[model samples]
Each structure stands twice: as structure tokens, then as C-alpha cells.
Target: MPHSVHTRSDTVQPRPAAAASRGRWTYRLGRWLGIDVYVHATFLALLAFFGLRAGLSGGAGAGLEQVAWMVALFGSVVLHEYGHALAARSFGIGTQDITLYPIGGVARLNAMPRSPGAELIVAAAGPLVNMALAFVFALGHTLSADAGQGAFNAAGELAWPLQFAVMNLGLGIFNLVPAFPMDGGRILRALLATLGNRVRATVWAARVGRVLALGFVVAGLFGNPMLMLLGAFVWFGAGAEAGAAVREEQLLGASVQQAMSRRFLTLSPWTQLGELAQRELDMTLLEDGVFPVESGGAVVGIVTAEALRDGLHDLGPKGYVADVMTRDILCVRPSDELSGTLRALHGRTLAAAPVVMAGRLVGMLTPRGVAAFMGGPQLRHA
Candidate 1:
């Protein structure tokens, strides 16, 4: 299968604007192997709420112990996601990052292999890692002779290794349940793909996933609120996965040249920010607009309307376009395919990207341009 992602270097990429802002609410624990691990704000809330509850029920020591147990449990989750990331890496795929939520952990891969064998291996890796951990803990339990004494209790009185063993075993088994966006679901899809088309296999798998999700909802109503939330996550995730698969299939046939805007507004390097702001206010609503900065008939950089406005308050509107524009401009060739460019633009902060040919700006591809290509109105009014 053809890949759509390309890596420039090993240099770490800063979080896209949205993720950077989300950082105000989340805690980044650390990074390893080029993968930044983040703890979502909600996960922290979980720790606080559970710790407080445990403290009120028992004492301060109980609170601390509960929090420590949570840390250890989430550590296993991190390891589980890394299992997937490393396996995907073996296939030459890149993982953007790994994030841990109260529900679970996710490793965001650049792309999944369309090949069934590759998919099976990547899907199975997470559970296999958990199973391996479970085995190691079981061996520890045997060696330490703590297996029969207080295993799988939430209280600190139980042996930690036994707690790890039980949790890992349960996690490995639970993940094997047939459901979309889960390891077992991927395995099912891979097996189904072996018989025929991938899209068709995805549709069938999604259908089964939805049915199983409904079962989860029913079980959650009678069992646990956590199970209900898990059901909703699986429900939405399965539907989203199906939609993404279809979009990727359509994008595989699209070319950027067919959708790029040949005419667009451009600013000179020496253009004052005041002039740019006046031009923007004189034109249509430019809140979400981005303009190319050109010099000597070549695209030099890109500037955003928000960035210009923000610079005005600091620089008194006298700054040149050169001072405001981003020099690290990312451009796509006119002939580049839609899927690949889309991959490049994913999670990026830029308002628009230049379409260059032979180092000359031929056009631009904005969010509107992409929307137009994706079957919406062709908004080319420059």
C-alpha cells in the first residue's frame, strides 16, 4: 500500500496551536523515544477525586496510596500504547504522540498499514504486551510467595505485584473483546479483509461494533457508569473510524492541482502591518484568512490575520511583513496528491499553504480550498 506521510527529520515538532493551547489544561509528564506522553486534565481530576474519596474513607496515607496505585496502573497503559507505537515503528510508521486519558491511552500513528498482515501485527501488539506483563507479574508472585495473600484489592494492604498481575491480565482479556477501534476489532477487520475488500471489511466490522456498543450501553445501565462511558466512546470511535476510512479512500484518487486556487492575495515583505490591517478590514471578513508574503516573484513566507492583529498591539503596526510572517513556510507542489497534502496539513497551525512549482508560488491551498475539493462550494473569490 502507498504511504501518505513523510518525515523531514528527527527534530521534535512543537504542538500545533490547538494542542499548545490545550497544554494550559493538561500536564505533559515527559517524552521518550521521540514520543511525548501527556496526561489529560481529566485524568488529573480522576486522581484528585479518587484520592480525596479514599482519604475521607480511610486517611491521608490511604489517599497517597490510592494515587500511587493509579500512577502504577496508568504506567501499564503507557507501556501498552508504546507497544503499539513500537510495532508500528517496525513497519516504518511514525507516531505523533501518546496521550493518556482517564479512559485509556492512545498512540497517534501517522497511518495504519492497509495490508492485513501488517494490521494484524499492529493490532495484536498492545494486548500481547499486556499479556507479557501479566506473565512477568505472575512469575514475581510465584517467586515472592505473595500470590495467595491480598491480590487485586484497591486498598494498599494487598501486594503491589499481585495487583499488577491481576490488572494486566484483566486488561489483556478485556481488550480482546470484539469491538471496533479495539485490538480485537482490528483483528476482525484484518481477517475479513483477507477474504475481499478493505472498505467492505470495515463496514462489516463497524456494523458489528455498533451492535456490540449497544450491548455495552445496556450492560452499563445495569452495571457501572464507567462501562456506560466506555460504551459511548466505543460507539463514537467506531463510527468515526468508518468515516475516516472512507475519506482516505476518496482522497487517494484526488490531485491538489485540481483544487488549488490559482489567484490569491499576496503581501510584499516591506508592507507595513497597518496597511495589511486596513486592506483586511476593507475586504470581506478576514478573521480566518492567511496571505502569502512574496518577494522577487517568489513566495517568502505566510502571514495570518490573527498574527497580524496580535503583532499590532506589540509593534505599534509599524512592523514590516518580514517581521510578522513565518519564515518556516510549508508548501505543497501543484501536482501533489490530495491525500498526501492533507496528511502534511493535519494538525498544523498555518492558516493556508502555498502551492509552489519550481520554487515559484503558483497558487494557494486554504482550508476553504480543501473544503471546496471535498464537495463544498468552490470559494475562489480573491
Candidate 2:
């Protein structure tokens, strides 16, 4: 249940190393428990707010202590994610990385294991980590109090150690809530998955998550702002999960030919860049660029704006397309399964791939094309 509402395996797919560069700061924290972890840049902003609030209300000492506690809390969160990563790894699933955002943490893995038992273990492991941490803190509190240690209190009544221990225990319990994007929701899905289709279970759980998100939002109206933000996150995250499930379902039995753009334009490798650019500028067609249909009249390569830009920097716009065209191309047959094609898309660094049938270019498949299909094109027609 601890790993339930945070279920976001769909948004993950292999992407360019350059995209990872955007999360460079996220990687700076280095690795923990042999798993790479990146905390987002916005987390620093949160720290600033934490410091500012502590300064205003409790002075430097109190502010610094709160910051320290927050850091420790996040440390616990990272370990909680590692619980998921470790359990998944034990099942032969590979984790991408665990990225910590202001809201919570995300452990990106390659794919869900087929076994419901394995999925259940991976999902349950996260909450166990939280509970473990709470117990450790509670034990420490007992030891410290017994040693006649001074209570960390602002007033006569508040016991800081006990309060901290109790808060962690409450957090551990709250995370077990049976709602999608939370641990309980995942438990529901895993249990249901054993009875029916995994997709169907996900759909039902996601609906529950959405309902929970709405409830949180309504409750936040008279309560904490943090709960309101968490509510919004849950609302959007649930919708995204459902949308992804629907998209995958739509692509299940199709082929590249069904989704590819048939309006593909071809270019000669020997064609000058200036000429190609002029031609593209003058054309009424939505010509992004052209693929090189090889010297033997077979699809061989693709030349994009990036290729053209590299050419322009080296030999001006007069540079031939062949000079900049990428010969290391990946293509797929029109009859290839859409699921396989999507997997290929994730594997390749290219933004688009040329669709070939019997060595002839037929259509083009790009990320944008995929989006267009999902957004406007009728999947039923395909």
C-alpha cells in the first residue's frame, strides 16, 4: 500500500542522455544503497522556504534544527523508495533511478514484473521501510528520555523527540491509505490483478485514486495548504495514469502502418542544404524534413533540422544533405506490431523513424505523430 498512489510506471521510457542532463542536479546527490538518486532543483526552493519560516518563527537555532529534521525526513523517504527498488530488483526488474521531488519520491523502473506476488512485494516494501524508521526513532526516544536527557521543547508541554517519532509513525500509516498513487491502492490493484486483467485492475484503482484526490482537495479548503498541493498532485497523477493505460490499450493490436504518417517527403543525399530548405519553405505540405531514400532507391537515412544546422556551421547552407545526414538509421516494417514499434522508439535516440515496407519508404513514425494519434486521430479507424 505504501507504493500505491505513487504508481507511475507508464511515463517512463528510455530517452536521450541529453534529457537526463536537465536533471543533472538531481544526480549530484550521488547514489544510495547502490541506486542512483536525484533530487530536483525545486527542492532547494523548498529548503529556502523552510529556512525562511524557521527564521521568522523560531530563530536561527530552531530554523537550523527544523532544516536538519527535514533533511533526515527526506533521507528516510529515499530509503523508502529504495525498498521498492530493492524488491523490484530481487524480482529481476531493473530500476531506472529514484528521483526526489518536493512532493515525494519517484522510483523509475523498466517495467512491472508479470508476477502478482512480485508486484505485491515491491509495493509493500516501501511502507515497511517507513515503519522501520519510525520504530528506530521511537526506540531512540525511549533511550534518550531514560538517560535523563533534556526534552527538546519550545514550551513546557511539547516533547520534540516523541513528536518526531509520532509524526513518522503517522506518515507510515497514512501512506498505507488504499488509494491509487498510494500504497493501499497498489495493494488493491495487485490483489485484483490476480483475479482479472492487470489493465482492468489498474483502471479501477485509478478511478479510486481520482476520487480520493477530489476528497483531499475538498478537505484542504479548511486545512493545510500542503494538503491542497498534495491533493492537486494526486488528481493530476491519477488522470495521467488512466490516460496512459487507455493509450496503451488503444495501441495493443495495431501496427506501424496504422499509426504512421503517410505524407512523408523524401530527399536526395546529394541535395544541397540551401535547396532543401528553400523547397521546404516553399512547400504547402507539413514537411519537417526529408529521409534519404538511399542510392539503391531504398530508405537509408534521415536528415533533420539538427543535421542541417550542423552542416550550416561547418560548410554553410550550401553543404550537401549527405554531409549532415545520419546513415545509422533504424526502420520498421509497416506490418510490425505497434507495441514492438513503441519499444523500438524507446530504444532509439531518434525523434522519428522511417517506416519501410519491402525496402521502400511508406510512412514516418515520430513521437509527435504518436501524440497526434492519441490526441485527435481516431484509434477506431486504425
Candidate 3:
């Protein structure tokens, strides 16, 4: 298929202010090599600092060359991310977009590959891209014996060819380390997944990642701060991945009925506002008003706090809940899977939704309820 024809889906809304802040330091565009890409704002600062350092330490000539090399280095990072995106695309998974952060590039795939083998390929493709670049540079260096070894030396003064080769090689090698948020860690998870269940594999891989991350932290505190930051990234990434794995396990065979909140408070149409405030609304610990119950076969919609406050002014304390209640209800059936329900929540602007079954409201599924279900100690198993 033509790369430009690749399909895109709305995974999440972009925060304009956040994107603006990020754009100041990096490039932002759609369709680079037929893939959407974004470069964060910090990449500029990184380039500027290194460029100035090279200039001050060497000369204008050296600085300009080094800056060019730095750009190429990040360019390689972009290619690495694309490797993953493209691999995922081949499997019919969609890539939201690739964002180049200060640390590295991130290709936000809509969902992880369901198969372990596919995941291994997607994860390995990135580091493989770096390896290819490194091989090309190495071959060039070897074929041209006239080129001095000084150009390849990391300890020596900044040189474009040497820095480029070293960065590419290092990136390829570093990403192979089995740590969370790194390609190696993903490779580990995929391999383990083939031998066991995904959740178990995730748990094992995450544990290994945490241990490796700690090793990096200790090493960084003694000498390299960069290693420390990378360690922290790995640590948190592993924890988050583990938690997601846990949630996935719970959602595997369960539906909305299993998790939705029962015994929810509801306000009857024509009920006095004062009575609602005293009975249904006040009893529930939530600050939000009760779900307005529909009458005369009408759908019930949510009424905001402002609507109730306004009703008080016009209808007095004796006025009914129906006077200010909204009537456009959007709800989901109890049989729907939790993941599908979560997706619906994102697609809709509703803060809370009623769960219905057999033409009757069975429960409420609010943001708090979902969070509680995900965070609860009891693990729902298949």
C-alpha cells in the first residue's frame, strides 16, 4: 500500500498548549516518509547547547560540523521510531503519530500487537534500523583506510563522522539492554510471552526491568547522571506496564455488568428539589447531582449543578427536580465489555453514564467507579 494512504485514527486529543511548548524546540508535521511525525520543542535546546559547546571547545568550523552531525543523529532516531510504526501498520494496527521527545522518539501505536511474535518484530525493528545505519558508517570507515582512526575516537575532539558513527552504534547497543521503556525490554516481554501467558510474561519482564533500572540508577549516582534519568524512566515505565497488564487481565472476560456501580442514587421527575437534596443527592458522598430519572417514556439526561442552582431561584425550594433536569440520556448496555465501555466514555462527553439492561437502568458507571474497579485489590480472573 502507498505510505501516504496509511489510515489514521483519533486516539487522544492533542493539548495545543503542550504541543506549542513542544513545537518550539522541534519540528511538527504530518507525513514524513508517508508516516505522521512530531518533534518535541526540546530537541532545539539539545542541538543549540551541543552546537555551542562544540564551537566554544573547538572552533566555528568544528561547531557547525558537530551541529550537522547532531541533526543526523536525531534523524536516525526518527527512522527508528518509523520502523516500529511501519511494522505495526503491516499488522493492521494504526499509529497515532511519532513524537520526538528530548530523551528519544515515541511511536504511539493505537494498541499493542496481540501476538507475541508480531510484538517482537515491532520492538526489534527500531534497534535494527539503528544497526543498519551503524553498519553503513562502519563499512564506509573500513573501506576508506585513508580516514584516520581519530575520526572514530570518542575521547578526542568533536568530529562529525566519528560522533555520528558512535551515536548510532551506541543507540543500537543501548536499546538492546533489557529494561522497561527500551526495545530490549519489549523484546524480553515478547519472548517470555511465547513461553507463558501475556500477564505472567509482563510481570516477569517488568521485574527484570525494575532490577536493571535500579542498577543504572546506582551507576549514574556514582558517575553518570544521564544513566540515572534513563533508569528512572525504565522504573516507572515498567510499573505502568505492569498495572496495565493487571487491568487487561481483569477485562479479559468481564463485561460492564461485572463492574458497574449498583444501588446508585436517582432523582425522580416532579420530585421536590429540597427533597432530592435531602434524600438521594445528599445521601451519596458524591458532590455531583443525582441522575435525573425520565418520565412519560422520555430519556433522562444529566443536569448540571448550575441548572439546579438556577431552578432554585425561579421555582423556590418546593420546585420539582423535573423543572431543571436534562432529558437527553446516553447510556450503555450491561453486556458491553469494559474496554468498549471505556472507549465509549472517551468518545462521549458525558462525565457519568447509566448502565441499562432489558429496558431498565441497572447501574451507574462513573469515572470514579471505573477507577475504583481498576485500582481495587480484588483481581477479576478468567
The lowest-lDDT stretch of 10 consecutive residues in candidate 3 is: 1-10
The candidate maximizing lDDT is 1
lDDT of each residue in 1-382, candidate 2, tens digit only = 1222233322213364633533555645887667677878888778879988997898998789878878877777788788888998898877767777777877876665656778788888888888887788777777767565555554664476666666667767877776675766777778888996877887888888888877887888988667777677667666666666567667778878877888766877777877766765534343444454466687768876656756877888788877888787788888898777777666665656788887778888765566667664322200
lDDT string, candidate 3, 220-303, tens digits: 999978888888888977877777776777667778777777877665677787765565445234454336375664446656
Candidate 3's C-alpha runs over 4 A off are: 1-30, 140-163, 268-280, 287-293, 303-330, 349-351, 376-382
Task: Output the worst ten-in-a-row residue range by lDDT, candidate 1.
Answer: 1-10
Q: Candidates' TM-scores?
A: 0.73, 0.80, 0.79
The CA-based lDDT of model 1 is what?
Answer: 0.74
- Cα error of candidate 3 at position 22, Å: 7.8
Better structure of 1 and 2 per lDDT: 1
The TM-score, computed over Cα atoms with residue i paired to residue i, of candidate 2 is 0.80
